[model samples]
Target chain A: MKSSRGLRLGTTLFSFTNEFHARQYSTEQLILKVAELGLGPGLEIVGFQSFRDYPEISDKFAEDLKELLSSCKLEPSCLAINADINIGKDRTLTVDELVVYHEAQIRAAAKLGFPVARCQFAAGPEVIRRLVPLAERLNVKLGLEIHAPEAVDSPLVLSYREMYVKVNSPYLGFIPDFGASAKALPPSFLAHFRKEGVPEKIVCVAEEVWATAEGNFGARLSEYHRRARQTGAAEADIHKLNMLFAMLSKQKPSAWIEIMPQVVHVHGKFYEFDKDGNEAAISYAELLPVFRDGGYKGFISSEWEGTAFTDDNGFEAVQAHHALCRRILARA
Target chain B: MLQTKLIAENGLRATSTGFDVEVRLPWYRGLPLSTVEIGDVVLNGEAINPASVSIEVNGKTRLPGDLATLYDERWYVLDSAMLHVSHSELKRGEQYDVAVSVNLRPPYIPGLTWAVKDAKRLTANS
Candidate 1:
């Protein structure tokens, strides 16, 4: 039952930000841990954040990093890069300046042997278009992250799809984060809400509205507000509910097939894993089949985001996530 | 992730004029140091004097009271800016809770912003 499509498992060092900050693991140790866990042959890195001397990596440092990865049997998969439009107070980066910034990161990614560089939404079509030639020349793919709150049919995403069709280039693609396909609100958010004294009845009301609300996001939000108010939910509770609505999307897992071919990398975004080794929030059971059927041949890095909500150890969470992925992929 | 590290290996003496602390800024594309405003430095719930703050970068020190104008170059990646704070209240071998408020220039998207208005406590090593 192995997937005919080549969907390799991997992970990003971001999962262990808490551990890194706690001094429990150095960057090299984290890479070795990933390898030791058998979680990856593919490793994605946030270049600036992960490296000690970022934006100024010496040749010796680069060589040392390469040697470490080689020794650990890990391959550089993607280099997550930032595109900060804000240059100064009220001074934003021009398109030309953005091109220069991204080009430099792309070159760095290439030099580090990463095949892909993930960019943020701030890198608009203009900036991405400008970087296409450089990416092509460097033999690296520039992937724009399609994270949560952005649906599959969003106008901005569709515009990128149109550009891809028009340009017909392999260098431009999407890195769909599984957060968009999440079926339930993150359990940690619920725990916080309840800890803040939000009534369970009110929480149920919010969940019902989220599951059944219709029309556009704005319309659905308004409907949720009206319904929650009728239930005598406090203003603070209502505000928290609104924030939850904004965080989780209502997109179906099968909807990803629309952009499947353009997916260069996948962020296997997860919150918590159950005792049964399943994601508590996201519906990966339904999502992986779409990739398998659509013939996606890329790395889906297990990105454990639970640290944002809880002090749950990322190393343990990622182990559960990869185990879940292996079970699902075996059935596919 | 943003972090603060005290550079004094011997720990701050009670009679010392000031001590050096390195503030590791979050990784972003590129931000001009001029736009970064470091607000009050709070130590164990007490606020430090703003006038006594000086910043050092690349071996050059600037005490213009404005962080944006202090640094000669902009910041990109996960870079740490050295901050030198002058105060007379620090005690030797004391673990003081340290916190600093920072406001970076807002990116084009309203959501991609960084600000610390409330003091977030950090554990200091003696």
Candidate 2:
């Protein structure tokens, strides 16, 4: 029997976004809760969400975080930082400015004892390529997230792959979010839309288009828009559901093997758990095997995004996700 | 969008010219004040003039129209800002149906602006 591989389970503090926003838990309390619930060994946090003045970590804050992590016995897995290209209202930041912006966060991540910093795709090849030396110097791996609407073989992803080949730095890589390879749109997603005053008929139309539309993501979205508009869906309702196209995708789970070697971290994105405790939309059964077989020896942060659509605190959902992943990995 | 939580309870307070309503940031993360657009405020079905409105956040107050230029100021996610509306008719202890709409142009997502609005009955305080 194959033993459990290097793939380990962890939780991103983002799973508690609702509780954090609702002021139910402070930052330090969230970390302690992760340990209290037996959810750690790896912890991920969005820099902007967790820190009051992010991209500029004060020495005091960094020292406090390091001490807290040591006491809780949790490892800092990744720091989710944004590349705010359009930070200025008049125009997007130039490549030089963008490079400087990312460097600060990367340095901050390094200071906080994180091995990886997950950057957004807003940093193009030029920005990424420029940051390679900094990443190498700081010993931080810059993993650009391959989120939904783009997959392992998407054209833009392909361009990044090409650039990675030329740059040939071990520090530059990918962080595959499992949401990019969803099996189906979760029923809760539709139900949440319905609860938000979106017409049931429109939600049903979105479900249908998600399952049957042929072509690229943009084409499929346009088709859904055209069809939903024809059903007399209001512009506001249509706009509400527009995010569905970007939050979930239809890529094959096996496609992950293409970039597994370069994957520095993983966002084990889940929406809900079924009666059997399996993830409702994302298939950890299929996804976990890819990482295991591909030799992805990194932290799979259990990122529960259901809080975006529901009022749940998501502690239970995250526990269920971790349990499911553990069960699956044990089988291997 | 957390519309129900956008407006705070007992958040209305009387100002010299009008009243201030406490409003929460709808997005998950804190953002620059400049990217925020205070769209419209309908008080008791009457639309408040946009030019006369200002927002107090991050320890400073600025007119809604000038928010686009205040890029350095931030609206922290946990703090609720006061939307100061210059209306003369709001009376202390009176309850009014107030509707507020705010839009955020996330700097990362080009050409897309996310909007959130909430309508709640709030009692004005002196």
Clashes of each: 1, 0
List model 1 lDDT by residue over A41-136, tens digit each. 889988755864454567888888889999999989999987767655556778998898788888888888899999887878889988888999
Candidate 2 Cα deviation (angstroms), residue B53: 1.2
| Tens digits of per-residue lDDT for model 2, A32-102 | 99999989889999988888888788899999999999999999999998887777568678999989989
Best candidate, DockQ-wise?
2
Mind giving the per-residue lDDT tens digits that candidate 1 earns over B52-109? Answer: 7776654567763455443326554334556677776455555666666666653434
Share of real contacts kept by model 2? 0.49
Q: What is the C-alpha lDDT of each candidate?
A: 0.74, 0.87
Per-candidate DockQ values are 0.27, 0.62
The TM-score between candidate 2 and the true structure equals: 0.96
By TM-score, the best candidate is 2
TM-score of chain B of 1: 0.67
